[model samples]
Target: MDDGAERIFAALRDVSQSGAPLYLQLKKNIEEAVKRGLIGPGDALPSERDIAAQADISRVTVRKAVQDLVKSGVLVQRHGSGTFVAPRMERVEQSLSRLTSFTEDMARRGMAARSQWLDRGIYTASPDEMMVLGLSASELVSRLSRLRIADETPLAIERATISASVLPDPHEVTSSLYMALGKTGHRPVRAVQRISAVNLGEAEAQLLAVPIGSACLQIERISYLASGKVIEFTKSIYRGDAYDFVAELRLPGPDGQEGEAT
Candidate 1:
């Protein structure tokens, strides 16, 4: 076992006065180790069998403890890989007043940005996509799904759909979908976003490195061109704890009316 694992075992063995469940005790001990820098972020953890054998605890207990930590955002588990400390993330504020791509938004904040391609293909438009992007049943739509990251932190999952006539090849989108659409002279000049508060589902939580049922912001956007033709329909999920959506407000000067609130 590595020194970190040895420290974790020592910490667990030293807890003699606690009345908490074994899993809970181990959970707190492991969390303290993380806080004390015994296990640094991105450091792979020892296997469950190793921890259980060395700590003299049941593997079930170890699993439960690790699961709790994973849900609490203290640890992250990659498929086919051991669990590791979760990466630290700085909270970000985004303006809702302007239309911009994820690349543009992250660049403005001076954060290096990148995307993990989850999907890029041409497929038959779904019913919702048909209505949102004004597509026909027989018409195909280009799909672009990506995990948007800024400064090595996964911030959002963006999935966009556009008519094949407008975007025949989803793979053409390199960084920004808006930029790719601009090449075809079909970029949207305006967009409408519907934002809602929700809990993260299992798939989304895993992708965003948050616990299942963690707070999230679900946004659906429809984009339109200057000619009033719909061009894009996109859905995005953002980590609520790491993002704050801000919009400027104004009151009408000449009439009893309110300004736009995104």
Candidate 2:
């Protein structure tokens, strides 16, 4: 064990005196070491055998602590490789005052953005989609579902729907949906969006590479054209730890009146 590892295990002395469980005490010590920068991201952790031998604790205790850390996004365990501290997640700030596409937003922030298409096709409109898009039962809706990535990090899962009349071919939307809509003269001028807190399910967790039940933001949006026609409906799931929605606020003037935030 390195000196840093020794420092991390030093707190194990008199574990019986600590009110917490032995594994919990060891967990706390490991967290403290991480906070103090004694162990950095991607730094390999000593094996369970080594840790048990050095800390004078059972391997079961060490395993429990490490598993907890992994679930908390503190540590990562590769199949054949040993455990290591997870790399830091970069948080992104998005302006709520502006309606922007993920590609445009990332471009504004100077981060490379890309998408992996999940599902794209013209399908019979579902009841919810028909209601949201103002389509009749006879009409179809183009559906586009994709994983949005920024700087190679999976940031969100976006699924959008549009009336086939407005967007006949989902294939036209290669990158930015707005750009594709603009070409068809159906781009939206404004939108109404609602955001809610949600927990990731099994499939969503796997796609996002985070623990199940991880907190995330769920957003539903309706985009309108200049003529007040609903042109698009979109739902998105964003990683809570990697994004912050910022809305600029101002105090009312002497008249107790406030203008639009923008």
Candidate 3:
């Protein structure tokens, strides 16, 4: 490393030992440095190895710190080059358990919903998909891949798989698939969903305006009709910063009466 780089690394390390987690402290130190004119926006960051050696911390810590900044749109990583600060943008989030469409959810919050359709097509089903929708191998399924937005802020990317027998025309779906299903007497009254945390890939981060490899929420939902038939299966990725899923629970009363209060 050059003298300038070594000095920069030492200064960053000194700033990082302030009782905060190493990664967060590193991020804050760099941002403060930039704000104070120590580094400009387009300036390249010290390599992870270089930062680790100077900081006397693990390379993993440096990588995590850089990745967090990237996810926050504070840093940008150029393949085969290095990491630098990112330009500004907005980030959006949606609750995973809401049984509403992107439009409806956003509207309730006084935001407008928009979509960029990545895919809309019909194809033969995967075994898991077929089993979930109760379709045969010969049956067709419609797939809709969309980036959902509110007030032009990307919230999530949803890839919904539907049984063609349930929804033969994808064009008829203008907004919420849930509402469309209700119109056709196939609306799901209940659903089972799973949630997991993961890091975003380059494509997802670019589309959602988050840093590549940033933490996100992955949700998989299977919604069922009143008759207990699965009507739809959807997979969505939500920005971790902006979303929180809450549920209200109840149990039978002491008198053996079922709880009824909402």
Candidate 4:
């Protein structure tokens, strides 16, 4: 093992005297090391067997700890290659007031964005769909699924559902769904989105070129037009290692700030 790995093992052993679960202890130690700059982003980590030998722990314990780190976005595993520290993600700037598309976002970042159409068709609404999209039983729903790419890297899988009456034809839609909707006078003016974390499954891992059970960002978004019409609802899974969502907070102007409650 290298110097960094040796230090990691020693620190973990020293901090684990309280006898916490081995895997959790290892995780905590590594996180602290990262925070303290002993480990930096994009550093290569020791292999499982190497770490096990260095720490005098079982290989299973090492595996569990490494896998947990991979699932939490702290590490990344490359197929046919070894695991490494995850790259730092650039914060994504989103205007909470406007409905935007992945292509548009990438363009603003000065990267070429692309999408592979997976499945597209019209279907009747299910009970869950009716609640999510505010659709009626008789209304036709269009589902568009795509694998999103930016700068030639696969970044996310997106599925969009909307009223067929709004889109009319699915094939006419291309790169940016928002742009397409704008052309039809049904552009979304506002949206509500919920964000969460998930572990990538085998299929998603294959598509995103990450290890199975890797961390991902799950976002569900519902957009509305000014007429109180539900324009579209979308669910997206973003590669956790490659994306960061950010929100900027501002203090109130001087007088209001002074009167703010603690």
Clashes of each: 0, 0, 0, 0
Q: Tell me the lDDT of model 4 at 125.
A: 74
Lowest summed-lDDT stretch of 10 residues in model 2?
Answer: 9-18
Question: For residues 26-145, what per-residue lDDT tens digits would candidate 3 score against the true structure?
Answer: 878777776776666566788888788878778898888888777667677767888875543344444544576667777787777888899888889999899889998999998888
Residue 10 local lDDT, model 3: 55
Root mean square deviation (Cα) for candidate 3: 8.7
The residue pairs found clashing in candidate 1 are none
Error of 2 at 96 (Å): 1.3
Error of 2 at 138 (Å): 0.9
List model 2 lDDT by residue over 53-166, tens digit each. 777889999899888877667777767888887777899998888888899999998989999899999999999999988888999999999999887567899999999998
Which is superior by TM-score, 1 or 2? 1
Where model 1 places Cα greater than 4 Å from the true spot, the runs are 1-10, 15-21, 36-50, 58-61, 78-82, 255-262
Question: Which window of 10 residues has the lowest lDDT sum in candidate 3?
Answer: 87-96
Q: Please estimate how well model 3 matches the true structure, expressed as its whole-model Cα lDDT.
A: 0.79
TM-score of each: 0.83, 0.70, 0.64, 0.62
- Alpha-carbon runs more than 4 Å astray in model 2: 1-86, 250-262
Judged by lDDT, which candidate is best? 1
lDDT of 4 at 62: 80
For model 4, give the 10-residue run with minimal summed lDDT: 253-262
lDDT of 1 by residue, 102-197 (tens): 999899999999999999999988999998877778999989999998876789999998898888778888998888888878889999999999
